[model samples]
Target chain A: MGKDQILVRVRDLHKVFHRGSERIDVLQGLNLEVPRGDFLAFMGPSGSGKTTLLNLIAGLDRPTQGAIDVDGQRIDQMSEADLARWRARHTGFVFQLYNLLPVLTAERNVELPLLLTPLSRAERKRHVQTALSVVGLADRAQHYPRQLSGGQEQRVAIARAIVADPTLLLCDEPTGDLDRKSEDEILDLLQALHREYGKTVLMVTHDPHAAARAQRILYLNKGTLSAEPIE
Target chain B: MRFWPLLWSSLWRKKVRTTFTLLSILVAFLLYGYLAAVNKGFSLGINTGADRLFLRHKVSLSILLPESYLGRIGATPGVVDVVHATWFAGIYQEPKNIFPQLPVDPERYLRLYPEFLLPEDQKQAWFADRTGAVAGRTLVEKFGWRIGDRIPLVSPWRKQDGTSTWEFTLRGIYDGAAEATDTRQFLFHYDYFEEARMFGKGMVGWYIIRIHDPKRAAEMAQRLDSNFANSFHETKTMTEKALVQGFARQIGDIGTIIGAILTAVFFTILLVAGNTMMQSVRERTAELAVLKTIGFSNHLVLTLVLTESLLLAGLGGVVGLGLAYWAIERGDPTGGVLPVFFFPPNDIVLGGVIMVALGLATGILPALQAMRLRVVDAIRRA
Candidate 1:
């Protein structure tokens, strides 16, 4: 509980989903902690609740019953409005589909999160340029999502995530839609962002190859977390 | 970087659908503008000052009053001058070619209507020759009539030797001196008309009186009507505005009809535009979810949806209003109902208000749906 020792903590987390008369528990009494600057990956079967735990930790979904402490704040108790503000200031997300806006070019897409900030126009532009450069997509800043290759689009999404310099990076199946070469390129970019910026990363994926790149890998089976990382 | 570029790009993402929706909106607003002008024209008369009063037979305008009423009306204390006219009901060539033709005492009538500017020489010529007539500039231009040309009018009221045709030599063309003055009349000598008519002799259709003070118009109208009350031919005296409004009312309930038509039109537009907005929002569910994840508040997402729909409507509304204005400026192409029509500033303002309201109405439900969408659910659906 010392300052800077831990970035995210969870205790007895439970998530339930209901369909008509049937109730399904996605996560049950989950307990874990992610220290600052650690890159953790969650891998499980499709219905093993790996993604649900990731969403809960990222404050993207509310847990049915549990405590989610991220950056010393109990996000489980935060209001939707407050959660959005907290997410803006503390978390960045990357999804399997790259999820970049099709209409905007790479630079403007990277500038999206900065728009929510109080940064001046010049400062925002410089930050956007730096983020794009870090992802090695500087020359393709003006290219739209459709104009970029799969790897390039994922790189743009990564640039968008880190543009506002959030402390926590939550990625969901980042390489789920890419080929082997593209997946390797994205994995490399994520590793560089984590090592250079000291970002705390939690990624959910079905690919063990993608998981092996993380500093520590955890397994979720039947809504429960495990210490073992299987190749 | 600004909100506008996002809004603009989102609105035009489906260019074909947006363009068609905008065209429909444009057409609706165009109808709104032009119909407003037409409605105004139908309900409004020449904006005469309060000094003018029209006296017609109480039973109906077609019922004529005795010629002796002229002198009595002029003798009234507040009345400065009185001029009487009889409807000629003349058809120029075809039966469909109909316009207002009246026979009046030229000298007196000209004095009463200072807005009709006629040349002194032409006035003298029209007065000297009983067969000569004066036409407005609009009438002359419409029929391509010139001075010294004999214009034949087929009269339904009178016939001479089995033919109902009467011919008059066009002597002069007068123009309107003021904004409200109508430049579409055909006037000739009342003396010649009275002497030649086979029946209804010595009777005039209506009397036009000019008073000294506008404040006394209602009092004068009441007093004048009372003077002819209980007589063989009772009189109804009213100001020129009331008289014109009465005539327009006799045609139909213009306000209600226009209101009903506009309501139907706008309601149809609302449904069509609302459906488009809903479809647009539904297609962008994942994008909206992405926005929420990126720290866009629920209210901000709602505003973005509303702003995009409003921009679509606003674009169409402006273009529609412009087309309406252009069409009105070129005058009514039909060249029948609306003789001289233009879109008033008030109507333009009204159309703009309708456009904005329509945008809000069409956008609200879809925006609300977008606002209430769960990011997790939205992303899953996408």
Candidate 2:
């Protein structure tokens, strides 16, 4: 069925900035698409526009020119407020650094986005508990971000992202700041979630092993994108 | 997510800075409360008064008005009644124990000012007995003066030939029924003072006039002045509040001055709070940038930072207002010279407004700064 339709489409997206009156282009006419339930990794060198492209798709920044459609909503045409509401309802993001609020308990961090929804406190807590359990850190739900190990913290971040039950999960170098064991554990969790939950996953990573988990891979080089199948 | 916990915990992250900012806010609000109270006190019952007016010499208060002017003013249209008064400028035997004296016509005075609760019999006794004097409850308590005790008052306006010369019998103790009226004054019959043949005789300092209708006060005042306008002595008519304000007026434009002080204080607080918020947002730049990348908008990041600023300023305002309430409520039992020493409900409301203003002012720049940050750049900041 046409690969069950496209979940996200980026067409002729371009991003430029001025550095002291000089035009500096980060992404030039880059086009990409992700099918439903696809696990894709974007790989590139520094300044290859990998992160830039991810940001554009995430609607975190406005491109000088282009159109991005996620689930039939032309996000590039949406107001900042509409985009925020859409992100709140539909996207889960994990970062290289665990960006959990340090003052909140792990459970509270996971419960953040759920607050924006109509879920009751009891339901939110239930979801938080289940997500933390899925992360194998149910015992650590009461701990602050500072009290958790790097891997534990990232696991908490992952739990927070998924607790909202979003359609898509975006991870940027999720294993880049971890030790080998932590990296392996994260990769295992990501693979399990992709296999069992059927969540569409997109990851930006330098770790070949991390990318190996993806169903497909995309290479971004100096403001351009190329699709490639995983080995 | 609910913004309140996010706002609250944001401040908890910088404990020292938050505490200091709160202290600064507390001090600023405390000052604001005191200044507002002073402005209120200075104009208290006078500005809105219903039953009183002062009849003083047009030229100056220090200059005396002829006692004869009382008859004409009392007879003026819409004039309910009138009484004569002069600042006796009397001294209690000791320099430290000072009390103001007014040589008043007891009969007309008691009839005019019902705010002073004194028995009609005692007032009559004071009038009949030439040496009799009446003291307010505050003066009686402060100096331990008893009724029927013979006390000597040294006159500042007209000193006796002898050092310890002036003498009078204390006949009645009076209490002011309202805050606007002074409870520290000593009143003796003008007849008694005239009997002593004291200086400034036949010439009273001012007149207290009560009118039939308060609404016609301005009109009656004009009539009273016009009656004496071309006469040998010119008179000025004003409400008792204006008279009281006149006394407080020697200190200059208190309202304008107080406004300037409050502005300066609020501006200083704004700068202080702004700097604090700026630093807070700068420190959290990476975190906020991350929030943005996760689909939190620039507006949301701005809102978070602004909410933190508001929380800080609001908490500070509440703290400061509480302190002011305690200080003023715990002050002098006898109504300290600054009698209207109250952190009024309006002042609390004003503090609330200030807190809101400060919060908005302090938050805007930090919020804008956070909003303008490049997500990629912030994540890479060392």
Candidate 3:
């Protein structure tokens, strides 16, 4: 793929963690490329470095070695402050637990990322309304997280992730804690975000059903990726 | 300003905890306000007058000074005028009803202390009637003593006929020019007191001397004291402010005592407030990590936490000081002991500064912890 076509390029990546005096290597010699608007999923057992790789790509963790270039900018070498600014402009994140600030209503939760921007209050309100409407939670704008079901809260989280109109959407087990019906709904939302919105999506999930919805699936084993799917 | 709602909401996330913490801070500041007012009252003389000097018996305040020494003091250089007053240890109705009753030459005393605002008619009325007395507005109101009413006081000093009661008609009520001025005194003509007394007829409690230049007051005081240094009654001369401070010091080191109490209170409050912020941050670790994931910088997170703390302290402090001011306005609780009782403006400002300092002291550690939190670890732990 052309350099412009590839949105994320990871080369010779390594990640190490330490617990007291013991050393544990999470990811080693990992290389991957994600094309623009591609829906990619990483599947592996727990402790197989699937989430670690996703974290590195999202600039939430720095690699022990090698480089990460996102949209032609070398993110691995960027300072923490610079990475934060880049993330604000280019990335959105959705977690499995649907991490919504419980004290805030759905509308306010969706407005979180917009607060970082210099958008006028009216403009931010419009953006939040549109993001909530896109997630089909417009009618529940004033409902707090405690007032909503697991599926509804996850929908609110998705609205927050997209409120800022970021370039990359990273999901770590986005539907891991949901019921089967809720899981299908979230996966459908993710697919719509990718196919309809043309978002570059990277997700880490252990569920084969969730993995199958992605355009490409990579199995992480022994700190490397392969085309074969995990059982 | 845009983030105020977020900071406010975070502060009250745990309603019970926040309410208790707020009450704790309120009580502490309220105590601070009362103690600071008391300290100000005790040290009121420091702000009284720089140009006026007081001359008393060098041996002790209880020891009387000869009234004849007033002429010698007035003759000294830098002395503009001199007046004398003798303490009348008198009580009204009951012994518990205590207040300052002084016998002074009405004209001279009124001329020297102009802060005592009395009407001209009342001054003439007092001078015309030999048995006339003028009471401060505060004392007049306390005992419901109206002008033209005859009030009798029981004194330990007896008349030549062995009677312990003295009667005088209330001629006027004097108001204080400033809020902190002691308006609880009762002043009457000294000639009547001298004629009625059985002994020590030519003695006075203290002499108040006005000088030409305030800056040379210490030098003038030394000159005045030397005039009586070798006489039967040696004298000590000092500024009126020093005399008031000396009287207050007899009660103990009020400033140090109040300071020690306030220090203990604030330290305890610091621990309580600090632990509260620490717990609040710890409980919201996952939420803070999510905020970071959404592109909030570490500095922004730190600011949010610190702002939350400041809001808490500021709210409690403003309300506490406000309540204390209201209580002080209601009047002194200690009947007549603390005559000059009111919260000073400077103390209110100091309270505000302490509130900010307390907030910063308690918020810093927790804010730093929030700032240094690694997003992945916090998320995983949560």
Candidate 4:
């Protein structure tokens, strides 16, 4: 694929964490390239650095050594404030636990990302309504997180992620906290977002069933990626 | 401005804790308001006529000076007129009903203190009747007294007839021209008091001298004191403001006392409010991380936290001061003890500034903590 078609590129990535004086290498000499509209999944054990790699690409974190370019921008070299602005403009995140503000209604939670924009209040409200409708949660807009079921909460979270129309959709075990039925529903929604909107998607998951739904799956072990599934 | 709702909702996240914290702030500011009013009342006399001087006994306010010195003071250069008043130390029926009762030459005292607004007809009546007295409007309201009423007071100093009771006809009720003027005094003719008193004849408490040019008051005061330098009753002379301030200092340094008390109260409030903000931020750690994930910069998070704290403090302060204003309007609850009991406009402005400062002080640490939170670590902990 052409360089312009590659939405995320990680070259010679290395991440090390320290606890007191001990050094822990989470990801070392890892490389990755995810093309636009590709649905990619990183499968690994709990300490295999799947989330770390995803965070570096999302500009939520910086690598110990490497280059992370997202949508042609060198995010690894960006300052914290610039990274924040870049993330707001180009990335959407869906968390496993549906980290919606308990004090805000579903509509308000969905409208969170739009507050950074200079959009009029009426325009923001319309955009929030459209995003909630896309996630099949338009009817539940006024309900608070406590009033919604786990699946519904995740749907609201998805609406919030897409409300800004970011270029890359990142999910970190988006269905990890749901029942099997709700898990399938979230996975289907992720699939629909990728297939219909042609959005670049990157997800980290340990579940084989969830990995099976992605267009490409890479297993991480010993701080490196492999095409073969982990035994 | 769009973040206001978010800040407000976050402030009330834990309703019980937020409510109790708000109440604590309210009570602190309420105490602040009342104490400020009390301090203003105690210092009210200091703001009176600057062009006037007081000539009193060199020893103490309780020591009497010869009444003959009033004429000498009035004859001095730059001295326009002079009046003398003696403290009666009298109470009406009960010691709790004690208020200032001064014996003065009615006409001269009225001329010296034009701020005491007495009707011309009543002034004539008071001058015509030797046993007539005039009560301030505040005193009249407190005792429900009216003109033509017989009022009796018991003085600590017994009369020549071995009786402590003194009777006078209420000829008038005088109002104050300014809000800060003391309207809790009872003024009676000095002739009646001097003729009936057992001792201290031909003596007065203090002489109030009105001068032509206030700029020359100090020089005139020095000149008057020299006139009695080596006499049997040596005199100490000072401007009216200084005399009132000296009297206040004799009781206590009211400003320092009020400052110390307010400092203690606000310090305790800062701790309470700071702890509350910290707890609120701690509970929202994961939520804050989510915000960061959605592109909220550290600076934005810090601003949100600080704004939340300011909103809480400002709300409590405004409400507390409003309640204090209402209570002051209902009048002083201490009977007639505090003569000038209204909250000063400057103090209200100071209260507003303190509220903002309190908000920032209580919020800084927690805001820094929120700002320094690493999104990855915070989410993992959550």
Ten-residue segment with the worst summed lDDT in candidate 1 chain B?
Answer: B332-341
Candidate whose DockQ is highest: 3
DockQ of 1: 0.57
Candidate structures ordered by DockQ, highest first: 3, 4, 1, 2
Is 3 or 4 the stronger prediction by DockQ?
3
- Sort the candidates on TM-score, descending order: 3, 4, 2, 1
B45-104: candidate 4 lDDT, tens digit per residue: 687789889989999889999888887888888889999998899989788999999999
Total clashes in model 2, counting residue pairs 3 or more apart in sequence or in different chains: 1
For lDDT, candidate 1 versus 4, the one ahead is 4
Cα lDDT of model 2 by residue, A1-231, tens digit? 373479998899899978899988989998988998889999988777777777767766688899998888888888878878888888898889988888778988888888778888899899999999999999998899999999999999999889988888989899999999999999899988988999889899977788988898898776888774323
lDDT of 1 by residue, A1-231 (tens): 576698998999999999999999999999998999999999888889987888888788999999999988999999989988888888899989988888888988898888889998899889999999999999998898999999999999999999998989999999999999999999998999889889888999999899999999999987889987543
Please list the residue runs of candidate 2 whose C-alpha ends up more than 4 Å from where it truly belongs after superposition.
A1-5, A11-31, A63-67, A222-231, B43-46, B50-52, B57-66, B88-204, B211-242, B332-336, B372-377, B380-382
Name model 4 segments beyond 4 Å from true. Answer: B47-51, B60-64, B77-81, B88-98, B101-135, B143-178, B187-203, B211-222, B249-252
For candidate 1, state the interface root-mean-square deviation in angstroms to 1 decimal: 0.9
Would you list the C-alpha lDDT of every candidate in the order shown? Answer: 0.87, 0.81, 0.91, 0.91
Model 4 lDDT vs. the true structure?
0.91
Per-residue lDDT of candidate 1, residues B173-291 (tens digit): 99988534567789998888887777888899999999988788899999889889999999999998888777778888777888898899899999989999999999989988988
User: What is each model's TM-score for chain A?
Assistant: 0.97, 0.95, 0.98, 0.98
Write the residue-wise lDDT of candidate 2 on B113-156 in tens digits. Answer: 67778877777788788778888876787778898899887776
Steric clash pairs (candidate 3): none
Looking at model 3, give its docking quality level.
Answer: medium
